[model samples]
Target chain A: MASQEIETLAQALARLPGFGPRSARRAVLHLMKRREAAMLPLLRALEAVNERLSTCDMCGNVDTSNPCTVCADPRRDVRALCVVEEVSDLWALDRSRLFPGKFHVLGGRLSALEGVRPEDLSIDKLLRRVEAGGIDEVVLAMNATLEGQTTAHYIAERLERFPVRLTQLAHGLPVGGELDYLDEGTLAQALRARRPVS
Target chain B: MASQEIETLAQALARLPGFGPRSARRAVLHLMKRREAAMLPLLRALEAVNERLSTCDMCGNVDTSNPCTVCADPRRDVRALCVVEEVSDLWALDRSRLFPGKFHVLGGRLSALEGVRPEDLSIDKLLRRVEAGGIDEVVLAMNATLEGQTTAHYIAERLERFPVRLTQLAHGLPVGGELDYLDEGTLAQALRARRPVS
Candidate 1:
């Protein structure tokens, strides 16, 4: 008979994203198929992350170190900070090799419907970091979603009196995205911000 | 920014069934989001499984102990033995609770196409177990695939000298399967194996 431990492992796997009951079972079976090469490494990795993983106190990005690799790096521009809704967005931007500046993770967007308040986010720390005076620019790189825009507006208002100049990531049809699939709001905004041929 | 550790963790999750680059990244984010509740528990579970999970020496079923809980159980029918290609099949049969007998996991089916030989499977051990004899009946529970059938036929030939009554799992329209979607092979098998109404 299948042991209780296997069932419990499947239950835990089901809670992870991209896994349902069937997929969890499949994953467990696959793990059983290769206990040493795949499963053991995964177990060890999970244990390592569990022990060492923590969010940077300064930027709110999840990392192994407290200050995070990006925040701790001397090469990155501390004067220019990119503020995003989550750590994933920060990673995506960093992966592009376009942003050499440090980041501030907002934790999540302003979701009044979900009863999330400004206090729920790292906004206060962001404002304090900006007001503490070395930062010259604040890039509000929240998503284009309604809540994201709402959060950006709220942050912009909060930082109105600060010496730091505020900015936002551009919104338009995504690169390589089909024009036919582009929403009306994006199309309108793209047209309004249309650049002339250089 | 995402640290090297988080990236390593995501890479490990990607090796598991159903997770890819994007989904692995998402899983890592979700883990970071719920560190106290979900991630920690998963780590502990993985550690537990890693430390304890092993194959039973007698039955070849994966479990926490050497002989496994099922093989050690005295109440289960020792006379009837269900033979399957993998531990997963044993688990499936056990979950159904239709069989109260013990199991013998063959590890894998014969597949010349995939370079899997008779020597690759635990067929010798299975034969040894049967020859030791208290096993009155042996049920062949391999999958419906070509490899499973080939393996079953090979095993039947090997067990020809034994006094054990050999049988197989019944093939038919699945309990809830619709006729329209059923293949001709299944339909024919179902027709051939049709039973009288009680």
Candidate 2:
């Protein structure tokens, strides 16, 4: 039936983050109705990107090349490494343009409920990369979640025996955010990590 | 060059109703990250639908055939016609399951500011269809906006000489809506179009 095709399309669309069945239906209908104006170009772009894309062999970033543009670039600091949970997180960091170091994607955090262990992540590969030497520092830019904290702790502890300096992104009040508006946890972290103004 | 691609994609996406550059970038990044899971299927679906789609010669609705399924179907009531501003509006009416008549998509509402004239729309085609005879009624189901009202008035004036009965969707408080919560304009419309409750 015609409904079946719509249903299949809806299901596929629903798999996208923040899209439920109703939104999926609306999106699918919009795409189908505007096939010429919007859908065709979108389709071509998707096809072109998919045909060319691959995972970065060095740092696990999604790219069209083996090591990814970031890892392959000679100017980027391979001596400094930033670690993150997902490619999205890595992309977010890249968008900030604050750090000019190489990256290691952990894929996911240590979550007992989800049965995600360190071995299941790229932790072993990270250790191998770290032990190979010449790396000056490792920045744990994991999420502020409990699992992320635990993973960072585990990684830091494991690297304590190694010669590389370990650092984590500073925890504090967000820029442009009022102190009174801060959550209890963030406020406490900000207080604990306070430094004298330069 | 890479930034230009992102910018172009963002601009294209932002042109879609309800999507801005932030959402467009999120969507593009999501597609790029989940190339196999989301992007490939979306691309294939878009391509498949685009390849098969054609505008209905009679009704301007996108379909796999020239006349469209609705226009081609002999079982549908040809004596009753429903007029709407857009194909989406027609689809909404169809979903209601109350209307068994054929549809006339006006493509857009009358907007003097936008320089959208009646002739620029399918008004001539609609008049031709109406003049062909056998139509008992023409239901105006344009939106409740200023342009929608203006377009409805233009259509009504144009078809006033015809022998067909003209009707519009009843205007009142929406289902599950409280009169106290309605805006001044809505309340005025509801009051003007008040009916005797059984």
Candidate 3:
């Protein structure tokens, strides 16, 4: 009943994350139903983002502004830079509201099997930023994966010459986590990192 | 890390059917990544659809033209009218290529508990169309639900005076459907509608 143009649009929408063939067609129809209220606004927002968005040259954070809002803000502690593997992680951490510092996105962890090398990531850029003097600590807030650990170790070794403190997120039972469902590795790490009643 | 505007855009994108908060943010980033390849084309498609689309007065099919592509096509068999519950169903039936006829969308099935009245649907319009003559067959291609059957029966009673033959889709195990998992009702229907082992 719809036109070929609409069909083409549905096909494109299918390629987006979380959209399959059925859902893509449904989404296209939903968009058509909300033509004025939602469709045009989404289109306009996408256009605005496309026109102005880019990765931050300093920290690799994604935003419409060149340096990104975080890097541009003076209130953030320049002495403490939290390192993450991706912008999504950075956003997650931002939502956590635990960190009051800036960030450096490595883009991805070093994966030898996947051909992801240290040079493949923004590691050099991060090193340069840290080398410029001002940052006193680098927080390794990478994911709890082997590749993440490898990247963290590599970065720590590289930053050994610099006079900055190196730290990482503690390994423990996650907040609201169930001990019965936890793996042995996590349990052992939690036990090893446990402190007295204080 | 993104500006307030970009963040607002991501929030809006999150409201789409298949996209959650995280995937919506990812979708905005994806749109930015594929600005030329996907975003522009999708935007153009939405604009074109908005500019030209509306429901066909004849069949209730939503498309870029007033009469809709199906109703406007002279090649379609106007004599065999297929009735469906919604435009999405119409689209799905159209995709099947099994029926080469026009359509009538009822918008929704009768639901006593939900306070759905016959006057709330396009039943009057359908009756008027049928009364005008030239239609030889009317296929009640509604979903095989209690409400759908109720609607079909009501339509049949209303058009009792019409000379057109009334028909419906057959009930059976779906193509590639496993018999072991099928419901007793479906198995009984499949047995009743059995043909030569072809």
Candidate 4:
């Protein structure tokens, strides 16, 4: 009976991104024994987030407000937009503090195999935002993968009639990454996209 | 400024049991971008657990009550006691669904090098509970480590005068563990502690 309860809890925990059945079982047992310390808190947090959270209408990022903090901020540059596959990509770019522009989350990459088409993503909304004018550049900061590249090319082509300048993040050896450690595909891409020294 | 926030969040996340700084940064960014979906839930859980949580006075385990559910339950075998070091350990044993007895949490092992003395742990409470009588057996289910063994020995010596039987979990090769993969210490100990087949 106790194991049944544990199994149910484990299933619930397995719904988390990185948690599998084994990890879920470990976590559930860990939480149950430390009920006062972790379980109740986690439960409350889940409930609270479920009740209070919303999606940012502009960026499609999850937030407590309709327009997220970044979208609502008047000081942020609206004309320079960074495009990404997911909110996680946007967060990664935000953490870099290199770009001082707004973001457009595509929700997911264009995956023909996965049946994700252009309309399935936020591409229509992105086109509308860009065609509204005043936007100078669109930085395609999607992952350096086939689906990411395909999505980027598709978006770029869609905006070909517009006056917006399009660009992508440089493809090269990552910072502190060794060439020997890099995968063959990445190495090839890095070599192919190499730029001449100034 | 954004990097600093990410760093701070990463540090906070790194304090979780299994995560390191790199994983913490990844988790923090994931949370931030999925603020509504993940971060808000985590924050609420933390707050709820912090606010509503309390430790069981009897066993030093975390619970919503003073004595805790285990201690309060009349169905549990009070005369058979299982001893463990941390609250997490107790929870682990509980999930096994074998023991039907009450528990005594020692809180920590006896580490002479670390200056963790018998008095530093809940050894006094353990002695008191044992001395109060009615206990048929006291199972020392502490981890199979030097400090844990030392702590178990101390408890055994203290209860030598009492009529209660002392027992311990069998130590040997773990289930599904290969003999070739066994560490030298574990192999040696297993050989030394070998028992005849019933």
Model 3: chain A TM-score against the true structure = 0.95
Docking class of 1: medium
Candidate 4: misplaced stretches above 4 Å?
Answer: A1-14, A20-52, A64-66, A72-77, A175-184, A196-198, B1-13, B21-52, B72-75, B176-183
For residue B85, give model 4's deviation from the true position in Å.
1.4
Model 2, first chain, TM-score of 0.88
lDDT of 4 by residue, B1-198 (tens): 233334545564454445566565566556655666666555544444445456677777665456776788889999999999987678788868699998998989999799998889998888888988989999999899988988888898998988999998888889898999999988987999888999
**Per-residue lDDT of model 3, residues A60-110, tens digit only:** 877889888998998899999999998878888987778989999998999
CA deviation > 4 Å runs, candidate 2: A1-11, A20-37, B1-15, B73-75
Name the candidate that leads on lDDT.
Answer: 1
Candidate 3 segments exceeding 4 Å error: A113-116, A175-188, A191-198, B73-75, B112-115, B171-198
Model 4 DockQ (Cα-based) = 0.18
The positional error of residue B45 in candidate 2, measured at the CA in angstroms, is: 0.5
The local lDDT score (0 to 100) that residue A79 gets in candidate 3 is: 95
Output DockQ, candidate 3: 0.51
Q: Against the true structure, what is each candidate's TM-score?
A: 0.88, 0.89, 0.86, 0.78
Best by DockQ: 1
Which residue pairs overlap in candidate 3's backbone?
none
In order, candidate lDDTs are 0.88, 0.80, 0.86, 0.75
Query: Per-residue CA lDDT of candidate 2, range B1-198, in tens?
Result: 123334455565555555666677677678777777888776666666667667677987765566877787787899999999987787668777788889998888889999999888999999999999999999999999999988999999999999999999887788999978888898898899778998
Q: What TM-score would candidate 3 get against the native? A: 0.86
Q: Is the docking of candidate 2 incorrect, acceptable, medium or high quality?
A: acceptable
